[model samples]
Target: MKILVCIKQVPQKDAPLKLNAAGTWIHEDVSYEVNEPDAYALEEALRQKEKHGGEVVVLTAGPARAQQVLREALAKGADRAIHLEDEKFVQLDSANTARAIHAAIAQESFDLIVTGLQSDDFGAAQTGVLLAEILGIPHATIIIGIEKTDTGLRLKRELEAGHYQHIETTMPALLTIQSGINKLRYATLIGIKQAKMKPVRKVTWADVESKISPNLQQIVRLYVPEKQKRTEMMEGPAPEVARKVVDYLRTAARVI
Candidate 1:
């Protein structure tokens, strides 16, 4: 089995975010790390490879700084990497992004592809779906477990309300992995040294420009919501206060 794992570099969880001057997106001057869910997906891929005896390749599309995630993945256990490098990719919608990836790896063959359930920054949860759609492959989302079978694969999907659903599918499939699927392994000194020797193929914007269509969606503006505090004390008879509270909730708060 040859598995392709798609990872993303995103702003660190605790990093402060600021809007750029145009408010079109967040400033890119913050610390970045491998997207959490994607990390889990990568871990799952590595684990699968360890058990099945196959190659694990990692892919990421982002700005130059994004190469850090690729290096980290290579150090962790990815056999090699493919980097879609360009500053403009930051503006690409899920559709165009998937198109770019398809264009880059059009000739490569893989039995399975893995991606995160969602991106931490955008939280769109659409790129993996779009990729699978563009590739015309069977895909499963929010998968937390994967069991290899003689014929194909068995997957455990996380559902709302703490529920789970099991599924079976064949190879040449894609999957969107949920976080906490496996324990992430850190790169050791030996792994770090070996990663430096790993191959990372770079695919630039110019390489796949023709394959990408004009973005159908773009972020018009991004801003932090303003915070405010308001408090009111009701002083009256119990029945009147109760009526007022109920009315406030029904009319203003809209909770009821």
Candidate 2:
């Protein structure tokens, strides 16, 4: 089995964020790390490779800094890495992003493609499905568990309100893994050293521009939400106060 895991680098959880001067995006001068959900996806891929005896390839699309996530995956037991290098990739919507990813790896024969349910930054939760559509493969989202079978693969999907449904699918399928399905493994010292020697193939955006379609969405502007506080005091008879509170709830709070 040749499993491909799609990962991403995102702003660290604790990193302070600030809108850029144009208020169109966050400032880029902050620390970044492997997206938390993507880490879980990589962990699951590694586990699958360990059980099935196959290669685990990690793929990431971003600027140069994004290579760090790929290197981290390599240190965690991925056979190799692919870096889709493009500064403009950050601006592309989920559809275009999926298109670029498909262009980069479409020629490769992969038994399975795995990705996080959604990116931490965008939270669009659409890339994996779009990629599956582009590849003409069946896909399942919010997958919480996977079991390999003689004929194909069995997947446990998470549904709303703590419900789960099991589905069976054949190879060449795509899945968006939900986080917390498994514990993540840290890179050992030996693995870290070996990762430096692992192959990291770089593909520039220009190489795949023709395969990319125009973006369907774009960020118009981004800004910090304005914060405000208000206070009201009601003093009257008990019944009158109760009636006033209900009126306030209906008119101001809109909760009644």
Candidate 3:
């Protein structure tokens, strides 16, 4: 089995965010790490490799600094890493991102392609599905569990309302793993030393542009979510207040 895990370097969730002067995306001065969900995806790929016995390669499309996440994945267990870096490719939409990834995979054969259900920064969740479509392969998104069978792979896909759907698919497929499916194993001292010696290949956009789709969308602007707060107090007798609270929960919050 040959597994390819798509990973991304994103701003740490708890880091303070500030939009750039042009109001397009956050400033790049803050710290970054592997997107949290992608870590689980990498772990799942490692587990699958351990079970089936094959090479697990980590792929990422980002600036050179993004190679940090790729090295981290290698240290954890991946066999190697591929960095697709280009300035023009930055800020591409989900479709373009998927296209770049598909182009890279076309150069090699992979039994399975795994990625996070969604990137924490974007939360679009469209890249994996789009990549599957481009590759003409089956895809299971938000996968919570996976097990290999003689003929195919069994998957548990997480759905709304705490529901899960069981799916079976053959190899050369895609899966977007959900977070919390497994504990991320820290890179051991030996693993860290080995990662430095592992193969980390860098590929430029131009090297694969012919295989890439020409249609690429541009982001007009990106902004930090505005901060707003509202407070309301319902004053009445205990019974009345309780009734109002229940109504609020049912009608206003609609979470119940």
Candidate 4:
């Protein structure tokens, strides 16, 4: 079983974010780490490889610093990694990103391709489906669990309204794993040392021929949502205050 896990480098959730001068995306001045959910996908891939006896190859697309996240994945037990580095790809939408991945994966046959349901920064859960379409493979999203069967792969998917669906797919498929699917493990000292020697393959968008051209839907002007605060006073005794609170919930807060 050859498993390919797609990962991404993203700003830490708690990291202070500031929009750029053009108000397009966050300013890059602080440190970054692997996207949280992608880590779970990596962990699941490694677990699958350990059980099934195969290689887990990690892949990411970003600038040079993206290599840091790739190394971190290597330390976590990925056999190797591919860094898809290109400046033109920095602002590319999910369609273009999936195109690049499809171009790269076309060269290598893989039994399974795994990725996080979405990136933390973008939260566009479209890549896996698009890549599957490009690769012509079955795909599943928001997968919380996976079990390998003699005939194919069994997966549990999280749906709206807290529902779950179990589905099965044959080999050469794609899956986008949801976060919290499994516990993430830290890199051990031995693993860290081993990662330094692991092979990290670097590729660029120009290196592969794009089978499809990118049709950009829209140029995003990223901006942080403005923060505002307000306070209101309730008059009268406890009962009146409670009534006011209920009114607030019913009208302003909309919780009721």
Candidate 2 residue lDDT tens string, 1-256: 9999999999998999999989888899999999888899999999999998999999999999999999899999999999999888888899988899998997799999999999989999999999999999999999999999998899999999989999999988999999999999999999999999999999998988998788889789987878787788999999999999999999999999
Q: Which regions in candidate 1 have their CA more than 4 angstroms from the true location?
A: 232-256
lDDT of 1 by residue, 154-222 (tens): 999999999999999998899999999999999998989999999999999999999999899988888
Task: Output the TM-score of candidate 2.
Answer: 0.93
Model 2 error, position 46 (Å) = 0.4
Candidate models: Cα lDDT each: 0.93, 0.93, 0.89, 0.88
User: Where does model 3 exceed 4 Å of error?
Assistant: 212-217, 225-256
User: What CA RMSD would candidate 2 show?
Assistant: 1.9
How accurate locally is residue 5 in candidate 4, as Cα lDDT from 0 to 100? 93
Model 3: per-residue lDDT, tens digit, 1-256? 9999999899987899888888767888889999888899999999989988999999999888899998899899899999998765667788888888877767799999999989988788999999999999999898999999998899998899988999899988999999998988999999999999999888898977776665566557986667788988999899999999999999999977
Collision count for each candidate, in order: 0, 0, 0, 0
RMSD to truth, every model: 2.3, 1.9, 4.1, 2.9
Better candidate by lDDT, 2 or 4: 2
TM-score of each: 0.92, 0.93, 0.86, 0.89
Q: Which candidate would rank higher by lDDT, 1 or 3?
A: 1
- lDDT of candidate 4 over 61-176, digit per residue (tens): 88898899899999989999998887566677788789888877677999999999999887888988999998889999999999999988999999999999999999889999
Q: Is candidate 1 or candidate 4 better by lDDT?
A: 1
lDDT of 4 at 212: 39
